[model samples]
Target: MGKLACFCILFFNVQLGLCMAPDLSILIVTYNSRRDIEKCLASLRDNSRGARVEIIVCDNASSDGTANFIAQHFPAVNLIRSAHNLGFGRANNLAAQHAHGRFFLLLNPDTWVEEDLAAAIVNFLDTHPEAGGCTPQHLNPDGTIQVGAIRELPTVESLFYQKTGLAYVFPRSRRFGRYCMTWWDHDEVREVEQAGACLALRREVFQQVGGFDESYFMYFEDVELCHAVRAAGYKIFSLSYARVYHIGGQSAKQAVSKNFIEFYRSMCHYFRKHYGAAGVWPVKIIIAVSELLMLLVLTLALPFSKLLPPPQAWSSRWTQWRGHARLLREVWTF
Candidate 1:
């Protein structure tokens, strides 16, 4: 849409004004997310009723014919096909090329957006000039705030807390919970280091930083991109005003049975790229040894998993970490 047309459409409430062409491009990457994609699209339609929203879905060679299904069902959404699975960031980058919106909202295929989400986030960013990106608070399938979606940057101490299970053991520690930022209620808006599940940024930022590093096949790429955004002097904000129900890890969890080796690999790449001459070998070693420790602790705790006095949320995290350790055993190269 033209500049005047874009503003006129975005500035009015859906009830008061007619929805026109999308001012925000909703970018999604689909990799065998057959079960989740249908609801996701429906949610977009219902929640975005009065907004002119551009919906784009990039199918990464899914075996389940996810692309064709989307094309047949959601004809208004732009569908892009790839010969091979392009990982997460690559596919989004590919779809972004076709975007005509003023802002880009990178969404996961397994998420449901609230009615005001598109308007709230876009309006907030439009008013706040320096904010490079904004992310909604992620909701679980049960509608509670999802933990670990927002956090402080990774540090030796926070990594220690997470790897050693101290974060679970001490759920209230601001220091131990640094990486997860567990103390905060998430009811207020704030700046954060990472929020990938449902994130938004201007087209200029996407062009300025480029797509995620191809080396990070799936994970940690978001964190790396956050680093780049902040390095460019743009703040990353968490939108407490909006939310999305994220199924979380529909695609990544499929590879968890083999152990999240790809996930770990991405983590190593991120550390090496940002840490300079230090290289990844050291990070690799720490991760390997930490996974070993995690395996031992969780194995011992398995029998009493139900008996633990810790909050259910912490137990959920421990279960996830256990899966991480299991994958590390098979995928650990060094």
Candidate 2:
């Protein structure tokens, strides 16, 4: 269709009330999130002043009653229930299929919204035409501002620092901790490379770059998406004034071992996908070295396990790293 013809069709559709996009479409992909969804929805309802919003929840085959709970309690939600777990990126992409809004907000089901979050973000996007997406300040459950809310794109150097414990050891060093942007307090509105928790993007950004990379499955998908968004000439921002409280890691808390593997696996895939074939090797090597370092520490600590204040911590650490060792072996051979 020609641009004029498409515009006319859209105009007529809106005029006749047949098709009209809301100001914001909130997408939440829930996996066993029945415990968190209610509070999340209630906060959106009570907050989000002066913005037309539609909530869509894609339930990724939750064993818990998440789909049923949304269907019963939140009739307004456009709920799409997948027959199997589609992971984070794919599940959100599935939910976006039903989204009709000027902007799309990717929110976790465990998040609580602040007053007028949607309206404020809508206004910000409206004014800042150059910005393709923005993230509000993320807060922890205890009401402290979350660290690593905004960050630089991950590089091989950053990955090495992160995986080898150098980032944690020298958090204030800009070179060592650049991945987490640890040197700066995240209190100002500025252009950022990635939004860690919640992200809101203009509809056109999706139309250009499409949704999160499905291959990611879970982690680093947002980073890939933001990279694509920026590469497409759209700037992203951290809107520090607006805020959302995140009950982080609700889903990952379910299966720690599986989640850990997926985290590294996705990281490796992300490096390869964006940084080319050679990128995967550095990430794999960093992970392998980290695992080896952990093994060394565990071997030294094994004799003193009983003397540790929490004796169970030593045992859990051993169990955790045992899985990591297996993962490292697989990575090397694969």
Candidate 3:
């Protein structure tokens, strides 16, 4: 049948008695997330407003016995325990493959939802046909707007600002803060390039993108996926209504060094993938030189000690810097 005829037929059919099945699956990839998963799951359960959301938890062989904890406490949760740590991308993909729902929610185990988050997202997608994915507004434990919740695509200037901490100096500047969309008030519905933490998309988009790039391993997978979805002619929306209290760095706290390395490694890979050979070289150089400067700064600050977190352990800060340096080396060689 023709396009108009098909549309009319479906419209009439839906008007008569067409009822679709429940099609929302919340996919959370967990790694040593026991500290936060309970609250996360509880919030989902409490705030779902009786909507049927298939919650799938993918455990990445956490040493902290997170899988057993979930199994013991939340018997209703469908948990997939991997024998070894498959990282975030592959673990999520593993669950996505097993998911029967049409809408996939790539959520973090550290996030606690507000009332009816699933319903709001599903409703948005149902109403706005162009939106390929929607990310909720991020709130910290204290209810402040969370940084790193959403971000713009990488550019030499934005990347440089983000790395050297110039973005903090001009947190409200459109150009300087473009990397994280920090200038926005978090009160409007708008299209965004990337949703760093929580993202919801239909199964068709997931199939078309073939899920996240496994090369990312952890970070920037969302940004890469958002890029692919937009390239496929779909809009990515940031909805202010669906709020999530994000306990950032829940998984990264386990091994700060490893996650630090993966962060830069993924950043380099993302740049290389998005920006071709011509565009990748400058970013590589910027990353190298800027990292060297940061290494020196952090080394000098290591002794002063009172500036950052973990008040007593300056050693931990130094250790993280060492890991970052290793990542810079890997990126430079690549």
Candidate 4:
């Protein structure tokens, strides 16, 4: 009778231990992302196996009935509807506060993960104690690679070169090379400074770094977070084992001017925060001049460019004008 009681107690303890293990909480922030939210959640729900995981959708007051759709369709999702768009950083931070998982994945609503993506990230983080965060290789909706993951932080010169298309002209110049990862083919895993759209971070490391900085309203927040993580002695890595399909530019394409302003402002915030006011001023001026030149070129070319065929000419001229205007607004406002 004594031996049987001891065995029963040990068995119960083992079961309790297994039950007590925590799961991952995938946190996705949405702002008028109704078009992609359903697909994103579905992919996550169907794919996240082998590890315990929960989905948290933090909606930034999307007027598009995004919250209602999720509530009705994805009953298992933990949804938090905000009163206003609190930008990406703050919304994710709000969701993270309620996340009960051992790890938190900051995913964009426009991205879809592979079935094993979450499990692979969990396994990688489990083995890599020094890694603070990890991101998967991102593919476009058409299966093309996206050029976002970069090893170097954006300096004023790098930004200028990239913005003005000088990098494409002289890809080998040290200044131009810094902007575009001149050597990277986007096929392999490598150390990256930031991967904003799809990234997973250990809860402890995330909390220790105080999460994403709210000062950055939209852009450069991920890069800033990476800097903070590295400062805290944690490594940021890109994992090739996992993949995500990113439907890029849904939000930014909405209003070109506002989006451009916010993006450039975020860039300025990043530069000033890291490189100081004095160092960033020169770069700011250069960016401003380059933007002015671009605007002049676009304004002069738009009329002539519009003389082509109806479909092709209209699209070509409109896109060129929009691109130039966006660049000018970003450089000057931010």
Candidate 5:
């Protein structure tokens, strides 16, 4: 009878060990994202394989029934509800604190993954030890390739060329124009400098770099993180095998004014950190003058240009300038 009890105890321990095995954790930061969160969760549930994966929803005080809906429908999801909105970087950081996986997928609530995406990314990273992060090719709802993956960081000149449509004038010159690789039809996998929409990182690398910088409230956080990862002797890659669909602008559309303001502020933060105040100051002044001139042109042309529809576009530009102006003002005062 004692021998029989020992055998049963051993069997129970084995089962417990199997059940406690760690898995990849998908961390999603959400705020009033009821419209697309369901679809996002459904995609993850369908696609995840090989790894024991867990979904974590870090909700930033979503009042539009986001929390209750996830609790009812996605009972398997680990929910962390914030008392107030902590913005994107902080919210994702909150979820990462509780992750138990070897790797972590920082996903947006409005993005849907393909069935093989998670597995493909895992395989790629497994083979490439130097790769710090992997992101799939993102597609718009209309099946067009979104330019989320890029080879170079946008400089002040690149921004000016892209904004003024001068990039189109010198299409082939890499130095004088934007070399977006927008027309490239190659299916080959390539190393990328940035991946803003969807990215997966090794838990170790994330810890080494200390995760996303909270100084950046929203925009350019991914770029900054990528820069840090590369500086730490890691590579960032864009895998062609994996794919995801991003319902772009969900968060931005919700709070248009605030989002624009925050985006410029984040950009300034990035500029100051990477480039010296002397270098960024000239660019800021140029951007301010160019934007004001564009706004003036749009205001005057509002009566005649229906095809161009300058007012709305111009207002958006003006808002961005105003945001940049605020950042410059703060920096100058400091």
Candidate 6:
């Protein structure tokens, strides 16, 4: 089918509400993601089984022709094109409005789903009424377990530990690594406060919590959604059986500086929204001091980096130094 034909079908679905809704709607948002979207869609085509699934791709005004590629190759997909780059949360919300599925799966363009992943998610949600959402085990492309897939809500102490390098230095300490749940081996089915990257949630649950908080442009939207769902008395779960391979940083790496700044900016927004300014004052102080200290150290080491390894090269260290300086300035006002 052509682009016109796809739009016509989508229009009829919206106006008439005539088609039967599917069991799952896998929603993907793309911005210059043609490189990964093809393989991601192919995996879903080859592996998804035992469920009625509909795939929707919301293109965020990609200059790389990502929208055209999907329209030409994956003609069955319901594609929504935006005029500008609506950030991650807004793009997914736009896709969800066009979706007709009982469950919504927020899938990253960089991931490939396993054969039974969709079916398993449907069955799990059907059986566990108390669970509002669930996330699969995220594995690196090399097949190693991806840590930081599940975590608790960030608090002052957790943010301090993360920024000051205490979390990395004491990965297994329950006190220092509580936010990322670093002590857990990621080998069991259990309740969690937040799950990142990809997740599946009931339509009602998503609607009830008002979907991803559109205030976030890049990071912590998932955390905010999970927080709202838990506050509404639904459990967020991590399932060890289902797995997805993630090629991390596929999108963010394209604009490293913007992403770095956005990460810290979103963190401050999250803290303000949930913890209030006064509640998270200590976190702001921690971030400012840590980033400032790193910037100063990197400045002093720039001259010596030429004598060190490539990782410590002047160019690399200078880039990191600039990122930290910008990050420190970003959080200073917060």
Per-candidate local distance difference test: 0.79, 0.85, 0.83, 0.80, 0.76, 0.87
User: Number of clashing residue pairs in every model?
Assistant: 2, 0, 0, 2, 0, 0
Candidate 2 per-residue lDDT over residues 240-265, each given as its tens digit? 78999998878877877777777777
**3 versus 5: better lDDT goes to:** 3
Worst 10 residues of 3 by lDDT: 306-315
Residue 118 in model 3: shift from native, Å? 0.8
Off by over 4 Å in 6: 1-20, 307-315
Q: Show the colliding residue pairs in model 3.
A: none
Per-residue lDDT over 246-274 for candidate 3, one digit per residue giving the tens place of the 0 to 100 score: 87876776676777677777777888887
Error of 5 at 304 (Å): 5.3
Q: Give the least accurate 10-residue stretch of model 6, judged by summed lDDT.
A: 308-317
Score every model by TM-score: 0.83, 0.90, 0.88, 0.86, 0.85, 0.91
Ranking by lDDT: 6, 2, 3, 4, 1, 5
Q: Residue 332, candidate 3: how far off, in angstroms?
A: 1.3
Candidate 4 per-residue C-alpha lDDT over 1-334 given as tens digits, one digit per residue, 9 for 90 to 100: 9999999999999998668655688999888889999889998888888888888999999998999999999999999999999988999899999898888888889998766788888898898887888888888888777765444677776777776788878765666766556656666767777777888899999999999899887877888888898888888788866789998777886665567667767777888888897777766787778778877876777687647554322246667567656666556545
lDDT of 1 by residue, 1-334 (tens): 6998878876775635434546789999999888999999988988885446889999999988798899899999999999998888888888999987778999989999767678887788789988988999988999998999887777555676787788988877887777888888899989888888888988898789885766667888788777887887888899886889998878766555332667776776677777754655566666778777767777777677668665333335465566666556643452
Deviation from native of the Cα of residue 276 in model 1, angstroms: 3.1
lDDT of 6 at 25: 96
The reply for model 1, stretches above 4 Å from the true place, is: 1-21, 277-282, 295-334
Candidate numbers sorted by TM-score from highest down: 6, 2, 3, 4, 5, 1
RMSD of each: 6.7, 4.3, 6.0, 4.3, 3.7, 5.8
lDDT (Cα, tens digit) per residue for candidate 6, span 100-196 = 8999999999999756688889999999998899999889989998877778988888888898899999999999989888988988999988876
Model 1: how far is 326 from its true place, Å? 7.8
Backbone clash pairs for candidate 1 read: 22-52, 259-327
Question: Highest lDDT among the candidates is held by which one?
Answer: 6
